[model samples]
Target chain A: MTIEIIIQAIISGLLMGFIYALIAAGLSLIFGLMGIVNFAHGEHLMLSMFSSFWLWTLLGLDPIISIPITMLILAISGILTHYLLIRYILKAKMIVQICATFGLSVFLRSLAQFLWTPDFRNVGNPLLEGRLEIAGIFIGQPQFYASLVCLLSFLLLYLFVNKSETGLALQATAQDRKAAETLGINSNKMFALGWALGLSCVSIAGTMMSNFFFIFPDVGVHFALFAFVAVALGGFGSIIGCLIAGIIIGLVESLGGLLIDPSYKLLYVFLIYLIVVIYRPQGLFGR
Target chain B: MNNNLQKAKLEPVWHTNKFIFALIFFLVTLFFFFPFINPSNFQLHLMIMIFMYAVMAQSWNVIAGFSGQISLGHVIFFGIGGYTSSFFYVEYGITPWIGIFIGILFSSLVAIAIGIPMLRLTGHYFAIATLLIGFSFQIIFQRWDLIGAASGLWIPLNWDNPWLTLQFHESKIPYYYIFLIFFLLSYFSIWIIYRSKIGFKLRAIRDDPQAASSLGIPVAKYKIIAFVISAIIMSPMGSLFAQYILVIEPERMFDIEISIIVLLIAVMGGVGNVWGPLIGTIILIPLSEYTRIFFGGTGGSVDLIIYGILIMLICIFRPSGLISFFPKKILERKKFL
Candidate 1:
């Protein structure tokens, strides 16, 4: 392949990877804190996308303007989800925990379909509409902004988790719930906060994606699948790992699509996932 | 722990019990006569769907429930079975009756290939791996033009010959009977495994793989065995599903939703048990159907919403399954009293 084509693919892939990392970081955080894989995580993303779509369509708000609103809405829903459904199943069997989230996913997807219908919706004349040409390469404004927002949020989340006291307390809770509780860090509240933060990340991703992609109940499925792979590949419960893995997946997917057939892009991602899972079950950055 | 283990081992075999015998007899008779009861075509179709799903769920339960290896990609085998059988019939003009066996073989081989590596991962990792595998299958099948690509393959219509092509024209009765037979075969195989030494080995591994391995259970081998058996039983359902629907698309055949639904049914009924899938299918199919009929318009997702709610509630309140609602004395026959 020409150097130009390779550069173009890498640029786009890295941008896509940032978005994947944002989504997967939330998933990894929740799993790290609660030890529960939220099967409905995709649904949460879908809901955010739908919310963005609605805000743009009904209220004539740009997706960029709707980002905060989407994040707030999804964060609350995430907290509510933990309280209403996840809390009850915390002590249940592994299968039960899985079923709870899986069921929630089905419920949310169906609810979206019921309320909004299955028709694909998109933001009309999004703020970032044109493509920017740089060095004989073109980048869609939406994609560039999405990647920028994703990187900024990733930085904020990293700072919040690593630098802030509350983030340390959250980490303590994730490390050892009982020990954290004994230290006067309410593990339950921490768990809820983790969910809120995690979902808010997804909300940002949805809002950014709404600028360029079609919004539908099932839109979350493919992205969610990629996020899952990213989380697993990066190592469960590791945010930095998720970011690195997400970028790797994005690169592989984009490059694979360009080099091989675009239709088999997912196949390439899955192949990499399988290889990582089989060879290094602990994941690239997992403890 | 030893006492409980002994008690588990000492659980009574109820095959000779009059109630058990009567129940088996009644079910067999019902299976035979249900098609002839003159139910509406819609009802028959529903029954076929229920039976097909139950078989699939039961197969899934063998690995997930009994062996404690949660596989979210069981639909991969099902899809393989469907595609294999369909390809055999379409390309070679072979009867599906024989093609079904080849499909089962193909599915078992694929299952083993997946299970050997995947079964090593515990719990959620395994689940995620399987889920990815299913998605990969979908993508591969969608792009593979040999299998008719995204549009999928339709079994040619043959009204004159019901026995050869496995097509019954407009009648749903034959499909119902075929699915029923497949369901019974799956149930009986599961029942045998549950009672056999293999079932105990699987349960042992499920409870504690380290302990089971220490006890010389050959843990990995047995898990593979369980996985293969599960895939073998599941393949026929896919084959029959292709015949019943007369249309097989990669997306529909290898849909992650199919895997989720089967897992839900098995878990909802009672995982790792012989009757769990059947009980689950009995409840879910009709529930989904009724919801679809009543809420035909205005965005028809009522059934899924309800199904989702029921799953969450069940997981929270009764994680063991709906079967747990029954008296332990009757279901378990522990100490016979």
Candidate 2:
């Protein structure tokens, strides 16, 4: 392969990976702390994408400008999800949680299909509105903006976790819920916060993705699958792991496409998933 | 402590002996008389489809329901079976009767290959591993042009040779009976497994894997066995599905929706029991038929919405399934001692 093509692929892959990281961060946090495998995570992302799409189409708001509104709406949805569905089952078996989330996923996916009719929807006014030629390689505006947005979101998340009191409380809850409760932190509130924050990441991803790709009902399923791969590759429950894993997966996808048909790229990437699953079940960066 | 609460909440039930016998007799009669009652080609076609899915669901239940290894990608076995048998039958004029055995062998091989690596993964990890396998199969099956690639192979029209097992006489009776046999076989196989010691071990593992392992149960071996058995049962479904439909395509067999349908059936019927799938099929098959009738060829995804809502409601309140709603005595007695 030409060095220029390789460089271009790497850059695009890195950008794609960053967006993946944003999509996955929330899932990792929820899984890490509450042990609730939110199978509907992809649905939430899809929901936000639709929200952003309509916002741009109807009101002429930019995707970035629509983020706060999406976050507010998603935050409420997350809290309601926690209270209405997840809270009662907190003490139930893990299988219950999995089943519940699976049901929720189906519900959300169906709802999307019902409303959107399986047609692909896109955001108005391209996020970047142009492409850049760098070192004899072309880069799209959306890809660069999406990557930068993803990076900034991660930094903000790191700061939220490391600097903020609520973030510390969340970490404590993740480490040990009962212990966190013993320290006078309300674990339930923390869970609510975690859900909101996790979904907020999805909202960010939704906005960014709607700018680049068409939004379909099953869009979340694809992203959620990749997010899980990212989570596994990065190590479950690790933000930094998700970041690195996303990039690795992007490279795998991009490079695999170069080697073979793009449609068959999942074959090679899933092989990596199988190898990692067998050899390092804890993930590459899982502690 | 938690066990005590669970036990209290889930009081077991026992069915009357006469009721159990009557139900079995009714099912047998229903299977035998189904073709006579509705000799129309469409009804038979729907019945065959239901029986095919019933087998698929029953097979999945062996691992996901009974053993508590929820594989969202159980379609791999179905796909393998469909591809193997269809390829052989279409390419070599080999009857699906012979092709079924070959499908079984390949599916079993795939089970062992996947099981050894995946036996260690529990819960979400296990689910993802199976999902990956499903994706891998789709890619492989789609790329392999020898098997007809994405467009898939079309069986040559051969209505003249009935003994060859490749003939189509335009009557659905043969298919209906074949699928009835498939259902009966799957149901009987599950029943046999339910009564066996391995079934007990599976139940124990399903309830608590670590404790089962601590009790000296070969958790991995039993899991592999359960998965392999499940695969064996599903392989024939594929063969029958292809033979009846007169077509075999990768997407038709290996789609994520296929896996989801299995989950829906197993979940709707109730997981971890023999009768769970039957209950699921009884409810879902009719609903599916109705949806198609109402939607009429091309609407939107109204059926998916209805199906999704039904699944969601069941999961929300009755995650144990319709079986949980049975009278206490009946449920306990039928659950297998």
Candidate 3:
């Protein structure tokens, strides 16, 4: 109805987009490295939120302060996932690869419900709890901060993957695992590193998200769905593509929810994804 | 090639000695007489479920297993099947028999529309697209008011005309027999398909679409055909299942769990094989149902956790499935037949 409302929605959507991109970055990185689309990526996000919530409650740590700890926790789980399950099914059929992660998702979702009792929980009083108005547009402090932090994390990940020697080795593995191995790079270590980096990226986003979003067992499902779309739409293995795609999805979701019925916002996003996949199988920015 | 085709037709794969005939007759007889044994209501319910899922899984198998296009969100058709027939039966006072045919027709058209675009994308792209489509349909059905909205449709009990309504009020016997007949017919049809050229061509498509296409098989057309066939196989069951339960909710109809369970059943029994879905359902469905009955399925997702673990383990350790455990000679059809 008003320009101010549209701007307000855009700002908030952009903020959420950064978080979505970070989540999609994890999925993209995993798929890029070993061609496995971690279906449990959503649960990893759920666990991270839970970890952040518990840290805030028990240790009185702000989500900002607890970001490192949560990242470490999720990174360790990512490694465990690789070493325990993924390493075995790397060369298995696509359905097996899918089912393994899908199974992990179901397991983690149920485990969370079993452990924390499926009740919606949230950070009681975050250190950052306010909104700021800029040029006739309002932005929540939590969302703005989360967006900034997510952007910062994304920059770091981009740097780590593009500039660092290990990062390039990880790239090398992704491009050609056998060639990378022949060149004396430990493809396995790079793979494990890929998972670690990937999950840690999401953990940061998840922690930031917990500051504002509801913390629940099934909270990750919608986010994970968005991440999957982002990963696919960005071309399965492109990190930068996921970032751009994530932002596009966020905008689409916000604008679509504004223009269309709010309930069908996600439907529009999926429609976009379907159109893209059907028309352009290589994705918008395929590697 | 010509001779092989003729031989296949002349000597169908299932022909065997009288001993096999007697065994088949005995098993059919036993299945028919199951309700007479005064079994627990739960047992009867379990059998009906097994039969129902066998149909669902095998239908899933036609596309996912044989065609090699893993559709993770396959329950969309099931939801479509259930909702369409239930809507007509409840609103127009029409018999479900006619409604079932309409459902099949409607779902086939839907599968065609979806499959043409969707089947063009292979492997993970196809799988995830179908998954999203499925979830999208669930969201739509949950909000759409015409088909009874989110709360779902409850078919009124037709005490006077149970047969016409496809609702059996007094006993589960009718549902069991009806589903058993369906299950057998479904299996028989699939068995025929598996032995026919279409079956071999589907298997070829499953193994490698590019190679199959190179060999002059119409890969895309065949994939769509398999996709529609799979949807057709799953369609009628929705009507029957809605009738059996007497309650059809969008949430219940299009649950991702149904899609996953169907996949788990197909994969665990052995993918790309006719016997696979039934075998998987036989072993896994009962275990799952019993777990729900024993462990309070009310409070938490204890069942999902189990299913997840079972699927993961099956994928990891026994990727070929449980059917592989049987001696090759019994289940394995002859090569070059």
In candidate 1, which residue pairs clash? none
Error of 1 at B136 (Å): 1.0
**TM per candidate, chain B:** 0.94, 0.92, 0.94
| TM-scores of the models, in the order given | 0.97, 0.94, 0.97
Q: Please list the residue runs of candidate 1 whose C-alpha ends up more than 4 Å from where it truly belongs after superposition.
A: B1-14, B334-337
Q: Put down candidate 2 lDDT per residue, B245-284, tens digits, no spaces.
A: 7777788878988888788888888888788887888788
Where does model 3 sit among the CAPRI classes?
A: medium
Q: What tens digits encode model 3's per-residue C-alpha lDDT throughout B1-337?
A: 7886566568755574456557767988999999999988889899999999999999998998888888989998899899888999899988999988899999999999998888888878988898899999999999998887799999988799888889988888999999999888888898778877898899998888889999999998998888888888899899899888989998899998899889888988889888888889988888878878777656447767787888888888999888888777766534312
Clashing pairs in 3: none
lDDT of the structure predicted as candidate 2: 0.82
- Model 1 complex DockQ against the native: 0.87
Candidate 1: Cα lDDT at B217: 92
- Every candidate's lDDT: 0.90, 0.82, 0.88
- Expressed as tens digits, the lDDT of each residue in A26-104 for candidate 1 is 9999999989999999999999998988888889999999899999999999999999999998888898899899999
* Cα lDDT for residue B271, candidate 2: 85
